[model samples]
Target: MPAFVINNHGGDTPDFDGEITFYVIVCVFLTAFGGLMFGYDLGISGGVTAMDDFLKEFFKEVYEKKQHVHENNYCKYDNHVLQLFTSSLYIAALLASFVASKVCTQMGRKPTMQIASLFFIIGVGLQAGSVSIEMIVCGRITLGIGVGFANQAVPLFLSELAPAKMRGALNICFQLFITIGIFVAGIINYFTSDIHPHGWRISLSLAMVPAVILLCGSLTICETPTSLIERRNFIKGKATLKKIRGTDNVTAEFESIVNASETARQIKNPFSTLLKPSSRPPLIIAILLQVFQQFTGINAIMFYAPVFFQTVGFGNNASLLSTVITGLVNVFSTLVSIYMVDRVGRRILLLEACVQMFLTQTVIGLILLTDLKPTGSWNHAEALIVVILVCVFVMGFAWSWGPLGWLIPSEIFPLEIRTTGFAFAVSSNMLFTFIIAQAFLSMLCHMRAGIFFFFAVWILVMGLLTHFFLPETKGVPIDAMVEKVWKQHWFWKRYMVDVDDEVIKEQVHPHVKYVKYGF
Candidate 1:
């Protein structure tokens, strides 16, 4: 067991609290490994996409022979095959998020993560040794399931365990690792763009090594103390909480958790809570956030950054290097977001990002409308300008929607409905992500201008929706926020006037009985 040192990292605080205790950081850091896995899975596909020729050759006998058999296959089996291999994981993730609560509740968070790792192992092995494209697609689908659980569980795990003050930063740290993984994948793909004979396979297979190590390491750590307490393992729960949360005045904290648990347990199967009338508003917000995050065009840029560069007239090699730059911008900007989220606030950042994103998408669309193609081989200067605009777009997203989009759903819902709410939210994210990611290259392939206009419209609609429906969540405490934020219905009244929080509170808390209300 590691030494239990109180590092005051998360939750709201003055500077004097210093960082969270070393042990808490260590425990939290272990959970962040799940983010690393998420990031790696996200980036690996881009690298694999760049290795098209190598991948085609490796499965040559299968793809070439199959191409001849399927009469007039206009879909280009090679591209569809690649798209399916990449997106199958996300498709599975949509399914997995729905069931993640069962894994977390029955097996606990640590064991569920171990189970995810097992899927990673099997998925990677299938990809590395597959004789047919179908095999690779299946592997990706399994990987998707693992991703689904990790994506939902990791943030919920970290947020519940972290101090309220530090939670935003640490939670944002999860996105930081995601950007890091994307950066690393971009760099590896750039350097290996020319390497023949199974380069993409090698790139894709690196995920299994870390997954194995994390899986093994997970077994030794304590479960989420809060989860244990919820399960009525009070003795072990208190000890585990004290160890991870440090020897500070944990009495109030303990009581708060127990109270929350008791309140939550009244619902029994809380996973179905999202569909009930009381839970609909937050569910709408969660699903919209997920949809907006995808529709913001980040993944479109990420999965096809190289292709975008090439369309603007950069060479294949230069396009890959430009993608690396995009990844770097993502990583560094995400770090800035981690620092700023707790300081400046989530709402301010989100609004600013949404507007900025709208402008950038508009500009990119206009640039594409110019129909500017390189006269010669490649115009490095013009390409660089487009690359910079793409980075600016990325910067806007990293600060606001990218991490906060995921962050809000986890924090905004009542504990009673959080699991189901997140499942619906994240699954929506993946479902739209799957559609956009799969159809992205094909969309651009058919009509580049039309697709850019498609995203341009999405950005405008997202800006309107956020302004009308979403609440400001920065600095608010998590456990009671669902009640606190609901008293004011002006935030969401435009969307569902009939289901206003003020109207509901009159019924749920007659005379404002259970929770205190503020103007």
Candidate 2:
């Protein structure tokens, strides 16, 4: 066992050998489904938006044939209604995340998630059956509720259950699936474009499938060990720990979790602790990481890549096809992230990805600003270059900000504050989602492609901030991480000395190491 893992809380080592349990994987997979749904909803909407002209024509024909309708000219103009349609989810998510902050902490993680799934079913049904834009907007708000739930719930769940060695990697998988979901949705929309001039009701409606799966899967999975222990469900908590770890390792792991939770409960109220100076640094990191994640305008890319491609003069089929390429890049680069995260660490990936995003976005914006029209029809080679650059941006995000954004919040906070802390962090993220997405269409009309210049500046600033402020947290045990963060902050440094001394002793003294704090 690593020295740091043996001495900190109370001296004890968990059993090292045991069969791997599927319980944790099951939870991860189910929760990942929520991200997948979020992605699918995101990707499909973009392609649907790009098809606005075609849908208008199709709807026009239907209306004209029905009653020679003249008063309700639904197809006379392309209103880009799809843009608002795409953004509704973010608005709903912002609202849901705020509400979920209280709910997750009060009702517990599992039940809150169940409630989210209910919203998913309702939203998906409304969207599928919508006869007007108002109905679709209503569904989006409901769907947003589900997105808000997972945004807060999955990271908290994964961070609590994963062993120290694998926690960062596992937690990042939540982000990975989000990228995958975006990719899958893009691919499906492109392949279905011919049949989808009817407005992609099926593609949009399919989001309900994963929600149902998650609802069913949640039933089989145990509550988070942290939550189980908090409610004083020791036996079930032990059983839950065993299921996540293994029978042989359960005793030590459970004790560690119980100890961490108790230590946190002893200190202060979890929600109020977020206000304390001691908690401020990580909370800042958590909040800003999420803010940067959104401001990088990655969602703008995912939700509007198809429209951007079309605006540049690509054929309709070709524009949708380019979205599939973006998805491919997102998926493969995320796989690269999965490989390097544990080895290369979070800070490096984030820094490099941020720089790459800034450069690519700047170049893309410059290209859009050019007046060089295709000599004949739109130049395929020039368009393809832009398409490739856009894919490069997707790759940059998949490897860094996308996954690490979610990873930081999940593992950074103390146990007592984790659920509530994540709630705040996620709410911050969703709020940005609302701001960027809701205003994106209007901004594009006013600024044209130059709007990306704004995003370029946003990505550059975030990269620099991350370089200075983000802490290195790759393999640190969760319990000790809070104290370490306080030790490094200027205002908290003097007070953290004794705590720092204890940490050093644990590090330097081979006789003592961080013992697992059994839950």
Candidate 3:
């Protein structure tokens, strides 16, 4: 068991009386391991694609017969085959995520995570031992199911555990772990890239280490205080809350949670309630934000970064090295986001990132459109410029869409339907992710530089949508956000609304806190 130490890292004080405790941080850190595994699965393919030995073994005819094909960059598989390899996992993930929504509610968060971990380990074993393409696809699909559960559960668990003031930062830590996973995968792939006969298998199998760790970590942590209270086990909830908050005086905190739970309990049917007009605003934002997140072209680049580098004139070694560097930049930039999310707010950073990304993608597209020599033969300056643009693009994504996309939807819904709503949003994310990741190579093979232009256009569309719909959620109580932010019909309303503590008292449902608090 990890030591439960109370390390006080100073920051904007949380909504509670005391500092955020070390237990809260440890629970969140361990839960965020799911993201690391998710990123590892997304990234390991890029390295495997670069391995001729793996490709030659898996896609025999394509590798042997295609004399003029770009052997080193692409895996030499036909477009249909590549599409199947990537999209199959996403298809399974979509289904599993819906199931996880119910599983988390029934079995609770920790058990749900262990379920995901088990699936991940099983899939990894199959992938490493695979002797056929069919077997690899099967493994990927199983892994996707695990990813679906992990992705849906981890952020929700973090949000429920976090104090309102620190929620955004802790939630952003989930994205940071994702980049770390990608970085680790890239580094592993780099060192093993030359290990010809079975290096790719070794790379695919290394993810098991983290999956096991996450399962063990989940065992040691407490269930979310929110879930505990909602279950009407007030005595246990109070105890858990004290452990997490590290103080005995939880009167205000307990009342707040009771109020939130009572409010969520208002619905007769979660689905019917979501269909109501009052709920439309937040629900729409959740779905569209997820859609926009995937369409940002982040995964198209991440899942194939090495191949992209090779496409732009990098040699095999240089391409993998460049991918590792991109992963590092992604991690560092997300740390910037985790630190700044509460201070700067979500919309501003998202807007700034969208502008930079729009410009970078447009420029990269235009450059690629120009007649350029193949991988090893392009101008050194031109190749360097392309690399620089990709780096900037990744940095922009890491700070904005990468973390905020996962963070916002988790907090946007009321607790009554939060699991169902978040599950749908996550499914949307993977659905669009499937479309983008599956079509990327096909688009690159046929449309070539046009692929970048296609992505840049989507970025513009998303930027417009964000400006109109996204709100500043930093330090806002989840229920308060529902009444004041999402329920407000107009975009400018969030900035215009004003409220003091008396007004807040009026806004909170009187019957909720009083009855649930037994006073």
What TM-score would every model get versus the actual structure?
A: 0.86, 0.85, 0.90
Instruction: Please report the candidate that would top lDDT against the real structure.
Output: 3
lDDT (Cα) of model 2: 0.72
Better of 1 and 3 by TM-score: 3
* lDDT tens digits by residue: candidate 2, 1-519: 421243233443443333436767777888777677777787877776666433554344422332332322112122345456767787778778867866766677787777778888899999878777788888888888888987777778777777766777778777777777777888777766677445477677777887887788777677887888776677787777777777645554555566565554554566677787666777888899989998888887787777667656577688888888888888889878878887888999999998888898899878766743322234678788888888888889999988888887888787767777787888888788777776675676567667789999989898888777787777666655655555655554543324344544443343231232222
Give the alpha carbon lDDT tens digit for every residue of 304-365 in model 3. Answer: 78777767777777889989999999999999999999898999889999998999988988
Pairs that collide in candidate 3 are: none
Model 3 lDDT-worst window of ten? 2-11
Highest TM-score against the true fold, candidate: 3
TM-score-better candidate, 2 vs 3: 3
Which regions of candidate 1 fall more than 4 Å away from where they truly are? 1-19, 58-78, 373-378, 489-519
List lDDT for all candidates, in order: 0.71, 0.72, 0.80
